[model samples]
Target: MPAYDQTRARVEDYFDRTATKTWERLTSDAPVSRIRETVRAGRDRMRDLILSRLPDDLRGARILDAGCGPGVATIALAERGATVVAADISPQLIDIAQLRLPHDLQSQVTFHTGDMLDPKLGQFDAVIAMDSLIYYTASDIGAALAALEPRVSGPIVFTVAPRTPALMAMWYAGKAFPRSDRSPVMIPHAHPKLMSAAKSAGVRRMLRPVDRITSGFYISEAMELRP
Candidate 1:
């Protein structure tokens, strides 16, 4: 299987069955371990950073919130006046995301369960994948971005695990988990290397690094590929 497909399969199973409730709680107001709390906080900051890159007025915009785990980002986008297609690999997570979305914003968001890059989801004005692409190899990520680039008129905003001492330590620590219990392995990349890989894979737009968010165990960098 291609690296993206392989990682997507593992990610689907992990989030759907193994870690569904764990994530539900983490994304919710429910209490969690200090470590996980940091992760949640970091994700909030990353999401905010992603939003900042877009225009302040999103009215009439069409956005794809790829790998929208529990709909937090989807709801936020809807609140900002953008019509959002929230897509994820796990049906279970998609259901949670749907249920978590406020009724008032119901008309602003649509939910899809399947590939985040599915062309059938239709073209989009912008695409935001948040932390969803972190588990793929740089080549796989490049290919994934290349596939979406043609369909998006604006930027394809995404996040990747940055090559850093803390993230490396976490990657090593994650190896201690039993194979059946662990989440997909995270692949870290530097921006320069990632840009080269994306270009080689036929991604025409420039991949520019926006910012990095680090709160305890969570370390993700945001980037955008614009036409």
Candidate 2:
């Protein structure tokens, strides 16, 4: 199989097996309320970063939440009155996300299970792929952006694992560490590579580190793409 396909398969498998645990980790660390509080606060910061980049009022906007895991951001967007289509490659995660929606808010969101590169996804007023680009290499990132470019009428917001010495060391260490539930592959891309991809896709882009984890070992960056 191709390297990108292999990486994608590993990511799907990893998330499929750990969907529930991952969702729990997002809201709570468990066995410690303080840790849970911290986790929630960090999640809010990331969510706010995405929201701040979007128009202040999204009541009539149509949004696509690419790689929407467990419907966290998807639900948030729907609650803000944006018509949302949430898609993920992992079926388990999509199912969990679907279950998380309230009955009244059901009409505001639709869910799909497939790769982000799938062409039938159609277009949207805006697109957000939170923390999902970490699985792709530079070339794969380019291809994914190419796929998403025409589909977005406005900005495309996504997060990537920044490429820096300290961050790269942490990524390698995570790979070296023994873990029963780890994915087979983990890739990080440099900001320049991502910008080049956006440029090739005929979009203007800007990036900034929105959050730091482990004191620089891992930084979450937010990138905005505009036509």
Candidate 3:
């Protein structure tokens, strides 16, 4: 397989194995939480931030929740009255996501197990790809953005693992001594490169860090791209 495909497959395997725990880390504040409460707090803040960036009301909007792991945000979008197409690369994650949808709101969400680059997924009024772009390299992100631009009528909101000097050093160290429990690979994306890609794709808009201290390392800036 090609490099990008191989990378994608590895990510699929990682998420598949950790789907349940990942969903808990993202949306729950249980007493026995595995991750830090601050981390969960940050995620909750980021989700609200993305929602705030979207239209005040999403009723009847056709939204694409790219890489919608376990469908936390997918169900949230459906509750807001959006017809959501929640797509994930891992079938295991998709199954978990589908299972989480409320019976009444099940009709509002269509789950698909596929890469975000799939062309036949159709178009949407808006696209949200929260916390999912971290797996891709800069070039892959550019290509994915190019693929998504024409399909979206409104803004594309997504997050990335930012490439700062400190984070770069940590990333290299992690690569040199990777833990078997974590994802096999993690690529920190440069803000400049992301902006360049958006410019090249003719969809450049706004970019800002989600949190000052955690932005460039733990979490990242929320980018809004428009066509």
Best by lDDT: 1
User: Model 2 — which ten-residue stretch has the worst lDDT?
Assistant: 209-218
* Ten-residue stretch with the least lDDT total in model 1: 1-10
lDDT of 3 by residue, 1-227 (tens): 16668778888888777655756445554554444555666776777787776776789899999988878888889988999999989887788788778999998889888987677889899988887777777677776777788888888888877677766787787777646756655677777887776566555555444432263235555777764
> Clashing residue pairs, candidate 2?
none
Order of candidates by TM-score, top first? 1, 3, 2
Per-residue CA lDDT of model 2 for 1-227, tens digit only, reads: 27668778878878877655756466433453555555466556777788777887799899999988888888889888999999988887887788878889899998999876676877899998887877778677766776777778888877776676766786888788676756544466776777776566554444344444332223566767765
Q: Cα lDDT for residue 173, model 3? A: 79
Clashing pairs in 3: none
- In order, candidate lDDTs are 0.91, 0.73, 0.75
Better of 1 and 2 by TM-score: 1
Number of clashing residue pairs, candidate 1: 0
Clashes (N, CA, C under 3 Å) per candidate: 0, 0, 0
Ranking by lDDT: 1, 3, 2
Q: Candidate 2: where are CA atoms >4 Å away?
A: 28-40, 178-181, 200-218
The candidate that achieves the highest TM-score relative to the unseen native structure: 1
